[model samples]
Target chain A: MKVNAKKVLMLTKISKSYQNNLVINNFSLDFNYGDSVGIIGKNGSGKSTILKISCGLLKPDSGNVLLMGKSFDSTEDGLLIKSRMGVVLHEDMLYPQLTVFENLNFYSKILGIKNVNTKIEELSTLLNLSDYLKISVSKLSNGNKKRVSFAKSLLNDPDILFADEPESNLDDNGKEIVSKIFNDRRKRGLTNFFSTHSEIFLEKCSNQLINLKDFENA
Target chain B: MLNWFKVLSILIKKDIKIEFQTKETLVTLCLFGLLIITVFSLSTENNSLINQNFGAGILWSSVIFAGSIAMVKFFYHEEQNKTLQSLLVMPVPSELILFSKSIVFFIFLSISEIIIFLISSVLFNLNIFSLKLILGCIVFNIGYSVVGSFFGVISSKSSSKEILLTMLLIPIITPILMFIIATTNDVIRSELNSNFQTWLGLGISFDIIFLTLMSYLFGKILED
Candidate 1:
């Protein structure tokens, strides 16, 4: 028996306010499968909240979030939807106590991906993290840590990837490697919603960039 | 319910690997442990009844505080270095992250408590290696870490987080520690038989209650 599940994330009039501080004011967005979009917004515009809410991190006071045609319910049934999506927020979400290999091993265990070695090897080579696998993530540079975070986002081979500044603060070579990894991911039918402050990258890889600069292009 | 053990194991293995490297936390923990032991030794004379009564209490208090000194830095280390994003991105429940952190802290507490047990016994010239007391301490330490971890996560974003963690944590943990002290007395002085088990039960219940609640609330705090 074959199971077919449609992947569409819909936010209908999502409004969130934290103690008289309004973050998101009646924002609505839709992401059907095969859509790679970037929301270009300054800090504290609720871009991260939007992604986290969809990922079940925050429950909007008044809104309806639907994942894959299912209500974004807090019930146990929604675990499947959450498991299929990957997210990297602006917050440092990686545990520093874990080494590069241990961190990758953790995702392998979390995702229940059998035979994790091949991808681990591939990601290490592609990201040039091979020498640093045994080193703690805390011992690495910010750029290298970001690379590990990138590799972790792909651990589950997630259908949807919500990345907040995925490739932030990297040199030219790092940017190229990040772009390459993203381009490879794009070919795999990976649905991604990205937010970044790097304008050069925004101009480079944003297939569907939404911003105040060019509504016409959007 | 999720597979919390997977969270627990991954956290332990990963933390142990890192902990072995610099031994930063363990070293500071031992220094703090030694300081507290020395304070107890200087404050009162050996063979004093007060020393015997306060021995287990001081042992655990020092161990818990010392363990928290480093373990409380667990999430903050991740926060500062920006590696926490990788863990948070996994498609697992956010509470698992907090749970895993707490369990690692609990393991550190247990290890420190073992060290305290050895050192205090030597310092006070008394043997505290009884099976019941050790078991009680284990349960008590686990409960303390579960509750302590929530505060640890809460303080990660605060301005004076260490003070905040201690302020909120100590009051809540006082009763748990009381139970532990009472149980230790029961085991050492041989006053009551299975009555000490009540504290163990209470400790386990506290562990379950706080672990579950914190596991749920971690997502909220972790959110922007």
Candidate 2:
């Protein structure tokens, strides 16, 4: 593989801690377009924290996070960069009171994706959620809810996807579907950065891997 | 630049749709409002000390207390599933998210107030149809929703959410409550006096000032 792609994400000397317990220490990495980086770590090792910081959900104690050469300092720059990204955190992030279809539809409209129904229908079909489109998110099982979350992140055909434990509640078939989606997106030069503990899942979906323990050397 | 009005409209629509589907905020607010009125009516029955003069105080206390509950319930949905975090990462500006929340809660609070007014009117034998009263309600609702939504986000992040919300909310809304009570007193007495005008002016001022300030601070608050 010719590693000449444009750098899509960069984290330089990032440091973060909670309650005086340092989680990520001087972490640094750069990801180019089409690079599928999987972050692996033990519990409380800051895999999710790094993802959150990179996606601008959590501000790092000190460091710079550049997405496509722009930081999240200015609202206009932040909005422009985030418009091309998607994220799935530990929580499902879908409204429990809303039906599966309504949740997707809401996000699609927010992202300004036209033909909302068609976009939602396509994602529902891809995620095997067509039958549950009318069902409230609170009524769905954990695995089903995970599928809905994944479907939401993919609704806009995001240029970058940041997911934490994307395979947490997924079954084998669900895992395959997610892996296929990731692989397809990668082939189209979309960047994927995710945190997970499943080696098998990472192997199927990612081409590069980083262990958070290495960052603790500081 | 794509106009953000359409985005705001869709955001409001989604919130309204979810609210109508669950009826959590509306039902809780209205039910709590009615219960407060019943308790007040019972406590003051046959008590000459509690005449029309105190009726405004009683009515607004119920409105503020019950409105606080509805405000907390309004944000609960966003916190439970981390939907606020989802919205934070979206392309839209952060202040717009807060604005949408305030708008939705404003609508719910208005509906809740109508029910509260009807119940209070029947129980306390007070009038409820004055244009001044309606104007006062609108002003009060805007002030309540903007300040409530701002503090509601902070409180929802705490372990003691309801207590924190009340502690933070009650003090900030004290001025608005005072003005509302004064206006309501005139409404209950069916007298459009200078006092009503002064209070309404104060309430409207508070609304405009707080709405702008909260909207400005909202984005900074979410950046953390």
Task: Find the candidate with the highest DockQ and give its number.
Answer: 2
Candidate 1, residues A1-218: lDDT per residue as tens digits? 00154546788878788899877766667766766778787677666777777766677877888776666465444656656777766554566666788878777777777788888988889878899999987788888877887777777777777888777766788889877666666776677778888887766656777562332223
Q: Report, for every candidate in turn, its global Cα lDDT versus the true structure.
A: 0.71, 0.87
Backbone N/Cα/C clashes per model: 8, 0
The interface root-mean-square deviation of each model, in the order shown, is: 4.1, 1.4
Model 2 - which docking category?
Answer: medium
Candidate number achieving the greatest lDDT relative to the actual structure: 2
Native-referenced Cα lDDT, model 1:
0.71
lDDT tens digits by residue: candidate 2, B90-208: 88887788888889999998998888888787787776678888888888888889899999998888778888899999999888888887777776676744587678778988998
Candidate 1 residue-wise lDDT at A165:
78
TM-score between model 1 and native: 0.84
